[model samples]
Target: MICAPPEKIFRATRNRPALARERARLARAALADCRLCAHDCGVNRLAGETGLCHAGAEARFFSAQVEVSDELELMPTFSVALSGCDLRCDFCITGKESWNARAGLGFDSFQMAERAKLALQNGARTIMVLGGEPTIHLPSALEFVSLLPASAKLIWKTNAHGRTQARELLDGMFDVWLADFKFGNDACAQRLAKVSDYVRVVQENLLWADTHSELIVRHLLMPGHVECCWRPVAAWLAANLPGVKVNLRAGFWPAWHARRHGEFKNSLSVSENQFAFGLATELGLNLIP
Candidate 1:
């Protein structure tokens, strides 16, 4: 099936200056006791305190480029790789660069807006905010989104473990959500990402995201986790969000500190990929090729 061209939601709200101001105000408030992600660090970012994500009041990003290797639905996209993350995934490809929020070149909302303009000129229809996790800097992200041109569709690529209150505050800003449903169970989550209640938090956020935006759930097929992670995630998606699209990714490779973990030390095998694909098909999931 041919996917439709990206639709811009910000156009309708562009005329409403008050709405934009209100959103900015609320986003700034969230920084007082940063409950942006599931970590709920509650650090006063405005007062120069850093949270678990290590992000401060200002927004920082490592790179901005036109990427063609994303999902087909969001191809020819302009991606902004933000700094800092709530989760410390053992296999993080970005390495320590993403972990240190202050390492990247800092950009205020105006600078990001200027970058978006250049991306749009280069024929990018989608503008994706990625990270360590973009939601960690909610106020800056929202401010940048507000400054963006209405021609490009906004896509937020996240860990899907953000606080519900933060998600509510960002209600009408995004057009699509590219979420990582990394682990299906809590034990793996705590062991891998150092987060508790992963399943519940991700599920609640996914349910909320599906209602507000076009949702695409991605699952990395990890070794020795087909039954524990893949099957359970597929079953849950089939039962609760049957219409949401799934991307059963087989691109896991030993990166960062993954070598220390026995399970994530190697790349996903062909057989493991096949099993995950077969499971998703059996569950009647709408998959993205």
Candidate 2:
């Protein structure tokens, strides 16, 4: 028997203009203080002050393109790469430019909406919001999604370091959440991403998101850190988030500042990849290719 597809929550807001407007207002208000991400810089972005993420009052985007090479679940999509990252991971593939809010071309929500509409017209099925870490620009991201064509599903590629306020702003808006759970332990996170409370923040945020959205957890198996990261993450998911889909990625290439760290200077080995996949299988995770 063929099963019916799961409901897309954002469809409920398609015809509700007032709901969109209200959400836009709330997003803007949250941006004023700029406590959207885990950093909690509390910089008054409205007053032209910059925070740790370096984002000003407005949202900045590096690029938007039709990408065919994405997760199988989110293929043939229009991907929007927003600027500014909450965490500074050593092996960031997008490089320093994406993390730096000052570097990208700036655009307001309306402009982004227009661009998204164009992509939809050009045969893009999904609108993927990606970034240095899109959560850093929560307000603009929200506004952009609100403006998207209801026919296109919203896929959020996030670092899962979003604050509670950010979650509140995004509640009931996203169709799928692609959460990147980078580290399983606090020490590894502190060493790689310079975040001390990474474990708690990401876990809490992911658990919260699972309740409201179609959650897909992604873990990029880094070289020499599988025991510290992958195993713990798999264990946690098996115990706490059973039935949640996970993507065990083997594509880890040393890039950007990764060369600076001795352990991160090389790509994942074949053995390491096998071990990661085996661990996932042992844990009974619902893994996606």
Assess each prediction's global lDDT (C-alpha) against the native: 0.83, 0.82
Error of 1 at 221 (Å): 1.0
**lDDT at 242, model 2:** 88
- Global CA lDDT of candidate 2, please? 0.82
Model 1's lDDT to the true fold? 0.83
lDDT of 2 by residue, 1-289 (tens): 9986674343434643345567767877777688988888888888888888888777788878889867787777888898878788878888776668876788577877787788878877888888888877776777776676665688889999988888887776777899998899999898888887999999998899888888889999999989999999999999999878899888898988898889886789889989999999999999986
- Please report how far candidate 1 places residue 148 from its true position, in Å: 1.1
Poorly placed runs, candidate 1 (over 4 Å):
1-18
lDDT of 2 at 235: 96
Question: For every model in order, what is the number of clashing pairs?
Answer: 0, 0
For residues 1-289, could you state the per-residue lDDT of candidate 1 as single tens digits? Answer: 9997564333324432345457777888879888888888888999999888888888889888889878997878888988888888888889686778886888677877788878888788888888989888777777787787654688889999899777877676777888999998999988888889999999999999887878889998888888899889999999999868898888887888887789876678889889889988888998996
Q: Output the lDDT of residue 189, model 2.
A: 90
- Model 1 TM-score relative to the real fold: 0.92
